[model samples]
Target chain A: MSKVRFGVIVFPGSNCDRDCYYVLKDLLQVKVDYIWHQEEKPKGFDCLILPGGFSYGDYLRCGAIARFSPVMEFVQDFAEQGGLVLGICNGFQILLECGLLPGAMLRNQGLKFVCQFIYVRVDNNQIPFTGAAQPGQVLQLPVKHNEGNYYVEEETLKEMKRRGQIVLRYSTKEGVVTREANPNGALDNIAGICNERKNVFGLMPHPENSSEPILGSQDGLLIFKSMLQYMEDGEFRYGGGEEFRYEEGREDDLDA
Target chain B: MKRVLVYVTPKKGILDPAGQATQRALQSLGYHEVEEVKIGKYIQLTIQDNNFSESSIKEMCSRLLANPVIEDYHYEVSDV
Candidate 1:
């Protein structure tokens, strides 16, 4: 293909479709198209994005209803075949609902909808999503959600840690991961994660919302740029061995 | 016709913020004996009697109505 094509599947209530489309099309200047939720399976696209918003009015759960959309069946097949897929905010919720990524989101521990720019430390920059970022670099990203509190059973969490599927965590500007820095109290401050194959990634942060300086931060654009780079030049899938900074409170930490 | 009632709730040991908030609200309202309040979803589905199967209902609950990762679900079927 001359240019890498991207498809942003728009669920019925997805409000951030334009934001993602704008970044991939206008800012990144790539071949991008929109796939309505009811549309047929997508083909010929290098990557697919599930943008942020209250799909199906977030009925039953943040992503429960949206997961069953016709396009998602194709998305599941796409991710299984190692095609790159990224989900943002509510999109991330849908990914979880569909078992694209392991874990579930609970209401913010504080019981409020939090909307703010928070710093996130890139835990594993080897993944395509963070290839352009420096190792352990703290990126200022915006997260707006009520149910961004990520939760996974303990045993699976250990396996995720061992495999480095965790790719980002809420953190201080100095790249320090701390409990106080966590906005929604996501378990171990997880903000972003990828699957074991590293082909599917999901994060509660809204990268599109912060993709430009005019939006108050251009830090989020790095994610899009890196993904584009991967489409063109990436030949290997990365599995990481970096130490997670938020390991302080895990079961193993107490033993140590 | 048939009716299915699915009840979904956060699994034990998982934090339930909305439920906790409700508990606090009740306490503030002088319902101190209401030691705990946990919120969950109740979904009622109307189905064709012949199309309703126990396995299918369970599948729907496990796949869509409840996320087994952090929530639990149970459903009852009744004639309508």
Candidate 2:
């Protein structure tokens, strides 16, 4: 198969462009390109990533202005046709602003930016990006953001739950998913979620930061590996596949 | 013209620790009489033509300005 093509977006205030670029190119050994936000179009990339940073200085809310960038027009089109899209931290907020994701990310409940490594449990493994994860598996990833609180309506939340679209959940040391363990107190302890089609995923955690053991953890590497596997297989399953879904209200020991 | 005021607040079950901290700070500064504080956003918008409707403004808020999940919105529109 040809080298997996990855595109990392660079906005004016985006500080993580190089970080994401290095991870995809050096760590994953994939063909990676950094696309400027102002570019009229981004071509020849299999996947698009909106990396973390304070875009437009986080004015008018975290991602409000950045959502209007020219690249998003193409992103919107790309995602509509089953292209893979990942949004981390501020990028997650941009996805919400653009309606690519169903929920919105608000300011941290504490009103201060929180930066640290967290244990996130893989909740849905049927999606193209998360297929490498085994259900109930926990991985440590870095999260640095001021606005990462995820919110969705009750009906939608229930539907997402029933549909197995939730990809990751914040886990306590005991491996219990709860709001108290969430860095930003997101709804249902949700750290990440995919669209109904399972092609697009938005999460607050920075998987690129944890993709290497030298960076403190290699837990996030599986996310990239999973995406690569999806590309190779050319199969994208919705609802993370029915076989991977755990029985309701199940709990297990946490490795964290 | 029609003017609308939209108030956006965090829904219950969602932590508002920032609002709590602000309330504590206000009390420390001798604003002891204050009962509570819930920090939220207030947006005022004006639409062209007197025939503009409240549902239109509500739709705008839902699509462009507000996220209806953890945020509940209430708006009142009046002729200006």
Candidate 3:
């Protein structure tokens, strides 16, 4: 298999860009490059990553201002074209603001910045991002954010569950999905999800931070390794076949 | 100039930790009669164009000033 080329987008305030680049380039021995936020083109990359950080100083909202960055337009197009895109932490917020992913993030339920290693159970291993793990595999990843609570309409949540779009959920070390184990009070204890096509993935955890044993856990490496396996096997499914239709509801009538 | 004051708030039913915290603080401060509290963003923009229509202002609110997924926004436009 050919080397998988990964592009890590670097927003002005993105602090985890180097971490992702290092994991892909040095640790995983893959081809990776940094894409600046001002760049309007994301050409010739097999995978694109939006690292975690307080982009645009978290102005207006966590990712509201950064959503309009020049690079995000390209990222959207890339995702629509069936390119693999992973958004982590602040990156997840940007993906939500850009409409690439469903739902929105709210301030932590406790109204505080949460920074610690939390467990997330793999809800679906069929998707490219989690293909390396078992269906109920548990991973310990570091989640650090002030606004990480995920919310969606009840109907949308139902649809997401039906379609297996809910990729990861906050869970106990024993893989129990319980409200008591929820770190940020996310809806259904969701920690990560993918778009309908499963090509775009967004999660509030910092997988890059825990990708090595020296970081106290190598669980995060599974996600990246899964992507590599998917690429090597040439079984990447392009989501462009079906028309992307979000379930219509009262929420869609907001602009009407 | 036309000044537009945009108010952006989390949609009803959405959990707002900041607003909840504020409400708790108010309750602790002896405001027992307060039913609820909601926190939101107030953005004031001065546009130089006099031809800006209400529809366009509403469009702006929906497109950039607010996230329709979790927020609702309304604006008042008036001559400065």
Candidate with the greatest TM-score versus the true structure? 3
Task: Give the per-residue Cα lDDT of candidate 3 at A66.
Answer: 88
Q: What stretches of model 3 exceed 4 Å from their correct place? A: A236-256, B49-51
Candidate 2 lDDT over residue span B23-42, tens digit each: 89999999999877877789
Determine the iRMS, in angstroms, of model 1: 0.8
Q: Which runs of model 1 end up more than 4 angstroms from their true locations?
A: A236-256
- State in Å the error of residue A175, model 2: 2.9
The lDDT leader among the candidates is 1
Measured against the true two-chain complex, the DockQ scores of the candidates, in the order shown, are: 0.87, 0.42, 0.73
Candidate structures ordered by TM-score, highest first: 3, 1, 2
Model 1 DockQ reads: 0.87
Q: Which candidate model has the greater lDDT, 2 or 3?
A: 3
Go through the candidates in order and give the C-alpha RMSD of each one to the true structure. 3.0, 4.1, 5.9
Against the unseen true structure, what C-alpha lDDT does each candidate score? 0.88, 0.81, 0.88
Model 1 over residues A73-127: C-alpha lDDT tens digits? 8999899898999999999999999998999999999988999999998888888
Residues A1-256, candidate 2, lDDT per residue (tens digit)? 3477999999889987888888888887888898999886778989999998999998756788899898989999999999999888888888888888898776777787889988888888888778887767788898998887788878888788877788898987555776567898677778999888777898889888888889999888788788877886777533243565545654433322
Positional deviation of residue B41's Cα in model 3 after best superposition, in angstroms: 0.8
Clashes of 2: 1
lDDT of 3 by residue, A167-255 (tens): 88888898877887788989888999999999999999988999999999989988899888888879854222332233445231112
Query: Alpha carbon lDDT of residue A251, candidate 2?
Result: 48
